[model samples]
Structure formats: C-alpha cells, structure tokens
Target: MVKIDRRWKQVVRENSQSPLFICLGEKHEVHLFETYFKYQLREDARTNDVYLIHYQDFTDPLTYGESLLAEWAEAFKSWPQGTAAWPGVDFTVTTGTDAGRPVAALAELCRLYPHLAEQHIFVQIAPTVVSDFDALRNWISDWGRAVKKGGISKLKLVLTDHHKHQTYKKAADAVRFRIETDLTAMMQHAAEFTNPKKGDPEADYQQQILIASNQLSKGNYNLAVAALEKAVRIARRQKLPEAEVTARLMLAQCLAAEGKTAPAHSEYQLAITAAGEKNLVAAQIHMNYGSFLLSQSEQAKAKTYFSKAVDIAEQIGNDFIAMECTRLLGQLSEGILTGDAEAIRYYERCLEIAREMEPEKRRQSSMPYVAGILLKKYGEKSAAGKILDEEMRTLFGENWIDLTKKPKQMK
Candidate 1:
C-alpha cells in the first residue's frame, strides 16, 4: 500500500462522503488561477454539494502542507460523514500534467473507493496536460497504480475555440470516448450530488420505467415486472403520485400477463384508487383491466370495464381511447348484449370517429372491418358499404381498393 501522508488522511476521513475533486497541473500554474476556479465552482455548488479540494500553492512547502490540512479539518470538523453504507460520488478534473504525488493521490482514491470508477471523470480543458504522451497516458490509466487494477472512465476533451486539442481529441476518441468541446453543462453532473437530491430519484425512476416499458413491449414479462417493482419504490419514495400511477399500471399489466391474478388485481385496485374515474389515467387503467379480463374469459365483466373506459374517454375527449373502447365493445356485444342494436350502435360510433380521423392514425383496422361485417350480417348493405368505402380510402389511395371485386369470404 502506498501510505498516504497524515495530512491527506484527515481529508480522506472527513470528506469521503462528499465528492472529491483534485485539479492537477504544473504546481504553481494550477494554483495561480485558483480564484477563477473557486468562482466557477462556487456557482456550481449552489446546485450540487461538492467537497472540493483545490490545490493551493504556498511560498513554503511547510506552510502549504499545514494550511491545506487545517483547511480540510476546519471544513468537516462538525459534519459527520457517517458509516459508508452509500459511499457518494468521487470525481476529478485535471487541467495540468502533474505526474507526481497528485497523480498517485488519485490512484489511492480510486483504489480505496471502487465507486470512483463509476463516478470519477477527467476533463482535459487545457492543452499542456494532454500535450505530453507520458502525462496523458498516466491520466488514462489513473496514474497506472490502482490497487484495484488501473483504469479510468472516458476523458472529456474540451477543445479550445481555435481547436488546439486535435491530439487529445484523436487520442480520447481512439480510446472510445468521443470528445466533447463543451463541458460547462456536463461539469455539475460529473460532480453530481452526494445525496439523492438533484432529481436523481426521479431520474432513476424514469430510467426504470423506460426499461420496464421496453421489456413489456418485447414480451419479457418477468424482467418487466422486476424493473417495475424498483420503479414503484423509487416513485413512492420520491412522492411522485403521477409516476407511481404509471408504474403501478404497467406493473399490474405485467402481473396479469404472468397469470398472477390476485397480485395483478391488487395492483390494479391501487392504481385505480389513486387515479379516480373520469380522468385519462382511469380510462387507461380500465382499458388495460378490461383486456386482462378478456384474456381470462371473463367477457361479461370485461364489457363493463370497457364501457367505463368509453365513458371516461368521451368525458376527456381522448379519441384514441374512445376508438379502442368502441372497437372492443363492438366485439363483445355479439356474445353478451342480448340484442344486435348495441353492437350496431358501437360499430356506427367507431365508423363516425374513423371518418374524422386522419388517415395516418389508421383507424381502418378496427372500425371499417368490424363495421362492414356486422352491418352486412344484419342485412344493412348500404350502411356497411359506406363504412367500407371510407376504410378503402383510408387504407389505400382512394382509387386503390374496390370492395365490389373482393371475394365472398373477405366480406
């Protein structure tokens, strides 16, 4: 083990929970513009709480060492780092090539804190640092002496407006990190919050929702359910009511697909209670529940939910849901409604909406096909023909599809 100096040890103990940053350079120049660095960092700290340690140069090494240690001790004297259940972010941005103790210090930080590999970042804003191959390589390898084995994340190569970082640019890209000339917006994020503020919980919940959505769409039901459980916890902890409703709805759908009826129904009830009827949320949940009921052969119960979906969709003027509910209602009418009038009315309503719909929405798949068959079966050829004509126009160019020449089985 490379023993840390007693001064650095105090810093490690006191400030480990806050993200640690070290600016590396030719010793004097880095500390020369320390004022400007402090100005920019102070502005950033308003949004993020970073425990920044800017390298200071004193006239005497003895005074510099004493002052630096005192500064750290004073800063965290009362603030507890607590037990390291969640070791916070570790970040670094080097401006000059100090291929000495500063580099070795980084190696030590990375070795002791494995989370550094995930959160530690390097921003090459100045040319002198990456101008020398030896210095650049040391940075790329995190000073080539991590006890956990040497490695580093992508180096952010900030180009001068005159584009003087061509060498660094090519090298960074060659190593698989595409160079970014603008680091202002990204600077605060790399130095992200130590706690779960700065919208991290919401961001994590959103990411999980995206993953769960794609997994569900791809029929990976089990994985989707697992992802949704995480999303639900994050949403609840963050006190995000809308996001919780969305996560629970998808969670219920996944459970229903997996045939976990009891749990699926429980999730549905929770979501529906949170999102009362007459809202779009209610419309969506009811439609999903109705589909689940249909899949389980509870057609009578399914129709009730589908009817509720139609009412909510109409109240909110959401034609998309209206179209789905109407189509399903028409299909269910044949088996349960005791008369063909309800079926004809549902099909006619679908056709009316389909006519007003833009061709791109492509409502033809449900309205035109179902309406044509049902109206014709009831010997209402003229009404069915008009709906069929609109379908042909919507699905194909007006002159492309002619129902008259279609085979009997097609009608």
Candidate 2:
C-alpha cells in the first residue's frame, strides 16, 4: 500500500517517446520504481504482452537469449502472434550484468526472432544492470544501428543502475529515483545491502540490535526475536561476551514476554553465565530473573535469586539493586502471611537504603507498603505500628494512615 514516488511517475511520463529508459538510484528505490512502471504499463489499454525476468536466475549468460526464447515460446502458445490482445511484447529484466552480457543476449534474441525487427520490443533493467559506462553506450549505439538496418519498429531498453554516468544519460532517457522515506521498510531494505563479507561484521551486529530495538518498540515480537537471535550469533562469532550477554538478555526478555518460557529460561541462563563475575550486570540479571520467576509464581526459586541479587548488590555497593532486591524479597516473604519477622526486617532494610537516597528516589521506597502491612497485622497502638506511623507521616503527609491500603489477603 506504499505509494510510489511522484517524481518517478513524472519522469516515466515525460519519457514516453523515448525508446530507452534507464532508472538510476539506490537499489530499493529503483526496484520499487520498476514495480510502479510495470503497474503503469499494465494499466495502459495498448499493452498486453508484459513479462518480468530476473537475469540472475539464468546460470549461464551465454544461454540467456535461448532461455528467454523458450519462455516466450510458452507465452506464444497461450496467445498467438496474430492476436491483437497480445501484440506488443514488453519485458522488464532485473540484472547485475554489465553491458556485454545483455548486448550479446539481445543479439541472440534478434537473430532468433526475425519478426522482432517488425515489432516494438521494450525491455527494462533495475539497479546495477550495467557496468563500464562507455562499453554500454557503444553497445546501445551499435545495437540501434543493427536493429535499424533490419527495419525494426522500435527496440526500447530501460536500464537502471546505482550510479549516474554521462554515457548512460546520452545513450538512454535516464531518470533517478530518490530515497524519500526513512520508515521501517526503507530502513530494513537499506539493511539488505549491508555486506558483512566486506569486512565489518560488527556493523552488521549493531544494525541487528538497532533493528530489533525498533521492532520491539513497534510490538513486533517475532521480528524482534529473529533479529536478536542474529545479534547473539554475531556477538558470539565476534568473541564479545558482553555483546553476547546483552543480546541474550534481550532475547530472553522477548521470549519471556511471548510466553516461550523454556527458551527464555535458557537464554537467561546463558546470559547469566556469560556475565560471569561482572557483579553489576550479574546483580541486575539475577534481580530480573527473580522478578520473572515471581511473575510465574515460582516463589521459592524467586526468593533464591533475590537472595543472590541482594548478596551481589551488597558486595558491589549498588544501592539500587539492594533496595529493589530487598523490597522484592520482603514481598515474597509477606505473601505467605505467616507473620515472619524476616519480611519486616527486609522491608526495614530497604527503607533505610531508600531514606539515604534523594526525595525522588525515596518516594519509590517500599516503606509505604511496610506501613500498610504493619497496620493490617497489628492495631495502631502496637510498637511496630507506632514506630512506622511516625516515619510514614513524614513521607506521606498528615494523612499517611489513610494512604496505607492493606494487602488484599491480609484483611
């Protein structure tokens, strides 16, 4: 449903009289324009015998003309030569060929079809159809002269290439397709030309990560997973453990989100193992893993990971991890409703860390929830309730008691 470029329509229209039309620009743009051109031709009432051929599909360039003739013979079987409905024969050839191969193929076609001289033969090539500009110009000129001698009606050639050349401009009606959109399709299409074989595998890996991130943001989980998989492979090949860990972690999260728990768990373990003794990342990964397990209701396993995360956080002096892991541990403990002293201790330790943080950070502390638990478990006159109420009042304004909403099952 993407619209073709307006300038391409204008250029094609303006060159209606020209027997040769050469499109030049980026590969995707030219390819898209080729589709638009074909659509325009098919819509015309005067056209019928339209065919498209990928030149690369033929293994041998020498047999290109013979192969094409065989294909056309089949078409002729379907629609007789005298049929007005199939009068003009039009072809769109997408090739990575230089001038010589196509010129030779055209010669063979002319030799085999003597009636070609008496009919209009239109051909188009997209993006990288020819190399050696001077050779192409000479071939076109020589072909035109030879076809003219045979009383040929008109032999049209539409060649597209990546570069602009004066010889091509002089030999054919050349039009350039400019890249106008920076959307996802265009971005992905552009990525198709990135050759990791040309050295710089890291660029390809980075591109995959970027593309995966974009896909993730668009909620295309399958595509994101595919891209991250490629990124993981690339990182492994590049011998970059950090990159591998990053990709695996992202892949794990994506798989987990999609409910593919087994693969997600595998990727998470791979990431954790790859992280090794990198405490900062290890702590964060353990906490995330714990959160994932908690979501799956694996409370015992979740507690184990949260405990490891807490130990690592304390070792690394990472207050963020310490606060988060401690809070999570408290939640897991309090979920049992066993009035465990351990749960209150975890919550108190988490609040102590949060209190030292900035006010903005302190507001996100688990202390408020601890107050709620204390209020629900015991009367306001209890020692724990009085102590928490005084602190909660300072954090949650004068209506702190009202702010405490008891955990659902606690009541």
Candidate 3:
C-alpha cells in the first residue's frame, strides 16, 4: 500500500464522505480497502457510517458492455439510500479497481434518484480500473456530465488521477477551481444583462494546457506543441500572464524535446522573464531550461540553470526535484561536458544524496540514474572507471548496467 499522503488522509477522514476505490488485476486487492479502512479509523475513530456495496452481487457481463450498466443499475436501485433516520445523512459510494461495472451502475443509480445528490460522495479509488477495452471512457464522460449539469447536485466532483492527481487543498488549487466555481455565479449576472460577457476563455485555456501537458508526458511532442500554442494565444488574449508563462514553458519543453534549440531557447527566455526568479514556477523553468540547454550541447549554460534549480529546490525542500537536477548535473559533469576532478567529486556527492532517499524511491529513481551516468562515464577504459568500477558494479548488477558496452542514449 502507498503511504497515506496527508491530502488523501484528509479525504479519508472526512466525515460523511464516500470513497469509490478501484481494484483490478489477476488477484484480490485486499490492501487498498484494508488500508482505506485502517487509515479511516486512525484518522477519525468515529468515521461516518458508510453504505458500502462491494458489488459481488453482479455477475453478468454484457458482451456489448452497454447493457451491463443498464442491468446493474436496475438491480441496485432497491438498495437502501442512506438511512432516512438522519435528516442529513452523509453518504459515500466506493468501487475499488474494477470501476467499469461499478461506474456504469452508479451513474444509472445517481441519475434515477436525484435526491442522493445532497448527500452523495462518489469515491474513485484507483481510477485506472477503467481501461480502453472496458468501454469505460464513455461511462466516465457521462458521469462527468451528470455531476456538471446539476442533475447530480451542484457540489463539485471529487476526482484524482495519476495524471491529474492534484491535492486541491493547496493554495494553487484555487486558480483552477476558481474559474469553475464562479461560472454559475457569473451566469446570474449574464441573465440580467442584455449581453453575456464574453465567455471565460480561461476555462478552455486551462483545458488546453492540461491536454498539452498530457501529450508532452506521453512523448507526443507535436500534439503538445499544437495544444500549447493554442493555449498561449488564449492566455495572452485573456491577459493571463501566469497562464501565458506556463504555456510558453511547456511549449519550450516540447520544442527542446524535438531538438529545436534556437526557438526553445527564445521561448525559455520569454517565459523566465514572465515567471520571474522567485515564482514557484521558477524551479521548473530553470530545470527545464537546463535540460533544453543540455540537449543543445550548451553544457555550461545548462549547468548554471541546473544549479539555480537546485538552490530553489533546496529552499522549497523539494528533495525530488533537487535529486533529479543533481542527477542531470552529475551526467553533464562526466559525460563529455567536463570530466574534471570537480565533476567526479559532484558525482560522488550526488550519489550520497541519492542513497539518502527512501528505499523504494531511491531504487526506482536515483539508483538507476546514478548507475547510468557512472557507467557512461567510467565504463570504458577510463580513469574514473579504474577507480569506481568495482564499487559501481556492486551498486548496480553487471547485467543491469554494462560498462563494457557503448552507451545507448545520452541522458
């Protein structure tokens, strides 16, 4: 089970809140639910009464997929809605992992009984349970519509995803949700006025920004550029300097990934100026700008930005970002950038920091990163090799990091 992040723990302890946990795979997901309940009790001894539907009751899978939802909804309508004993009983609905069937059924139930909106908390534990083959995409879209159209109540949806996984409890959460929260309020004014104020372009701009980021993460640079370019236009037109800076930064990242040095550099400068040195986004801007410079073989310039990022990351106590930047710095130090003794010293220092991370995190990220950089630098008849070769092989097995072979890719 994943550690209880404070954001999630807040959600779990929320009295009268409902969580839909998703569990799927070849075996049982005892951990997710067990952890959920354990944390719930630990956070609040008097956790709200939860009306849980494990949904082992449904066995039929409509070969067509659509019929399953309809049928399940019909069967589930009879279950007790929160005990009418409490006038304002908070109700939660949860489905861990295998959310396709549960989602389909829940959507139907919610649509049939509008009263549930007042008390319903729909929890999606591990939303990845709904995959492409499950035809769950349409179900998810319909569910979102239900929540948005006021058919499911005016309350905002509670959503979290690995991609859109956000801790909305943060200060930054306000900007994104603010536009959405105020739209209905804006509608009231529109009704009284002869003309509706132009639609809030930030709404669409935010969406485009999200799309662009997703595309970039998935290695779809061209599509990311397209979406980000559109977002940039909307941001500038709407006088959203922050949005413009964010879009330009993302666009620069895409451009750099595509190996377009000159334009990427230009965008980085414009975005850096817009974000200023002290903005929270400065760390990201510097880190990414460093990567862009490194990609263009501007190793020295890259090193400076990386160092700046390290400083901000340290100030902010973002060890993850600090480690990643340090890793990149280590790469540059030894890999054709400047194989000086100072670089060698930095590599050893960075490795020490990596080793200090939590065991799982260190193994999954830093260990591989440090091993790759060292092997690339010292693995080939190199002075660094003769000194650290035995130690490096011990850290990463010979099979995993082969020093004798030419490096397959630049970091």
Clashes found in each candidate (C-alpha, N, C closer than 3 A): 0, 0, 13
Please give, for residues 1-411, the per-residue lDDT of candidate 1 as tens digits. Answer: 011123223433443332212333323323333433344345343322233443343233223323333443455454354223222223333433232233334445445655554542332233332234545444434322331233333212112221233333433222221212112222233335433466678667766776786677568898788889999889778777678889998898788778898898889778777777788889888888788778778899888988898899989888877877887887778755377777877877876776667776743345446545554655645775666666566666466333323222110
TM-score for all models, in order of appearance: 0.44, 0.49, 0.41
Q: For model 2, how does the per-residue alpha-carbon lDDT over 50-150 read when each residue is reduced to its tens digit? A: 43443423233334444445555555565434343322333333332222333444545555565654444565543234445454465455444444444
Pairs with backbone N, CA or C atoms under 3 Å apart (clashes), candidate 1: none
RMSD of 2: 23.0
lDDT score at residue 59, model 3, on the 0-100 scale: 28
Q: Lowest summed-lDDT stretch of 10 residues in model 1?
A: 176-185
TM-score of candidate 3 relative to the true fold: 0.41
For model 1 the TM-score comes to 0.44
Residue 170's C-alpha lDDT in candidate 2?
69
Order by TM-score, highest first? 2, 1, 3
For each candidate, the alpha-carbon lDDT, in order, equals 0.55, 0.64, 0.54
Q: Rank the candidates by lDDT, best first.
A: 2, 1, 3
